[model samples]
Target: MEWHQPPAALVRTMNVVLRGVLPSPLGRGVGEFMLLAFTGRRTGQRYRVPVTAHRVAGDLCALTPAGWRLNFRGGADVDVTLAGRTTPMRGVLVEDRAEVARIYLDRMTELGMRRAARMIGLKFPLGRLPALDEVAELARREHFGVVRLSVRT
Candidate 1:
């Protein structure tokens, strides 16, 4: 399916809602939610966006079909609010297709075999999951952007 950006107003609303709840005790149980704060490329102003983050190999990763990843073309300092705690982190854009595929597959696997497969545009036998190599190929072909964030100790 073709990806369409959500309306800006809706995105802003989401950010507001997520920010209000994510730091609360109730929001602490939402494992996948996080607040990613970074500077806008052109405006040089700070912007925070809510994302569904996946932990991979001790790093936080987010897959966005949106252009926000462009702000970290090389790497950017960021603050991530996760589970009611905010920490300093370095956000790196993973441009290598192979690495992107690996991360994507890892996240999908975490999300659930069947759901992840379907989200990645894969159709397989009802009970079977695609191999990692297949997922990598599909991810490379589709050009998904992966933003990997490492905590700055």
Candidate 2:
């Protein structure tokens, strides 16, 4: 898929809005959105991006089509702010397409067919989720990455 970069102004606006809202109760009610804080691998500067996160078997999972996930390629620690609370977590970049597919499929299944359909811009039969193999094939074609985070209690 061709990547289209958003305008810098739009990105600036989103960063401002997310920074202001993410720490509020309103942001917590806005579904699985979370603020991911990680250090840039090259610059050693902190960066925060808003991502949709899922709780899978006691771990936080995020699927991204962006390059920001590459920051964790060196197994760096991160901070995730969800529901107005921040926690330290260790992040792993799952490069195996099959494993990424499995986790992505599970998250889509938990989101249910209708919502998942809207998310991927596909139409699906009611109550039916895509098969794991199908997801794997799509992931391979689309180059999706999975970031699995374990919260340090």
Candidate 3:
């Protein structure tokens, strides 16, 4: 399924709202969002990006298809700020389409299909669970995946 981007103004507005709330005392109220701070590998530039994340198993995973995710291609150190606390973590990008599809399906199953679809830009008929093959095709076409973030030990 093809995805559509929200209006640029709406995107900007959400960025503003997320930037304010995701680091505040009420951060967790918004659910599944955090601020990720990382330095670029080649340019050494710093970046703070807001991402939707869900805890899977014992780690936080952020689904993304943005270019900035390349920074974690091989795994990189990062600082995750959530609910007014900052912690160092390692982020590894999982770009394999099949694996990404599995994780996405698992999350949808866990989070409820409608809610997950709204958050992840997925579209499908109501009450019908999408097959893994369908999801894998979407992942392949979209180049979308998750970044698995774990506390640095």
Candidate 4:
């Protein structure tokens, strides 16, 4: 699968919009997005970004193919802001492709096809989740995996 490289301007615009919107009262209505604030293990610089929140077996998780997700590779503490509230949490990156795909499938079904498609940046019909094989194939090809977060307090 080809990686989707959105234009730099578009990415900057989205970052600005998400930062503004996700912290506002209006954010409560957008349950799918959360602001994750973590210090870069290497840079010692704080980074914050909006990510789609996925629920896997009652726990909050996020699947990403981005290099930034590597900051959680060895399990890191993060501040997750969801629905206009911030909480400390531990984020662990799970790289097992099959497991990630299974969680992705579950999340897709749980979130419904439309929302899942929007999060995945794909367009598909609204009734059914992506097939397991299809999801696994994409997950493998795209290096997609999950970062499951546990609340700290």
**TM-scores across all candidates?**
0.74, 0.78, 0.89, 0.84
Q: Worst 10-residue stretch by lDDT in candidate 3?
A: 1-10
The lDDT per prediction is 0.74, 0.75, 0.81, 0.81
* Clashes by residue pair, model 1: none
Cα lDDT tens digits, model 1, 1-153, are 122345689878878999888777766786668888899888899988878777778877878766788887788988988888888999989888788777776766666756554343344544555567876766655567889899876
Clashes of 1: 0
Please tell me which predicted candidate would have the highest TM-score against the true structure. 3
Clashes of each: 0, 0, 0, 0
Candidate 3 lDDT, 1-153, residue by residue in tens: 344456779878888888888878878676667899999999999988888778777778888767888899999999998877888999999867788889988877787767777677666664666788977887777878789999999
For model 3, the local distance difference test gives 0.81
Residue lDDT tens for model 2, 26-122: 7777556788888989899898888766777777777777788888785778888888878899888987787888887877777776665544333
Candidate 4 lDDT over 1-153, as tens digits, reads 123446789978988898888888988887889999999999999999888887778889877888888999989999998998888999999968889888877777776766666675544543456688988987888878789999975
- Point out the higher-scoring one by TM-score: 1 or 3: 3
Instruction: Mark the regions of model 3 whose C-alpha exceeds 4 Å error after superposition.
Output: 1-4, 125-127
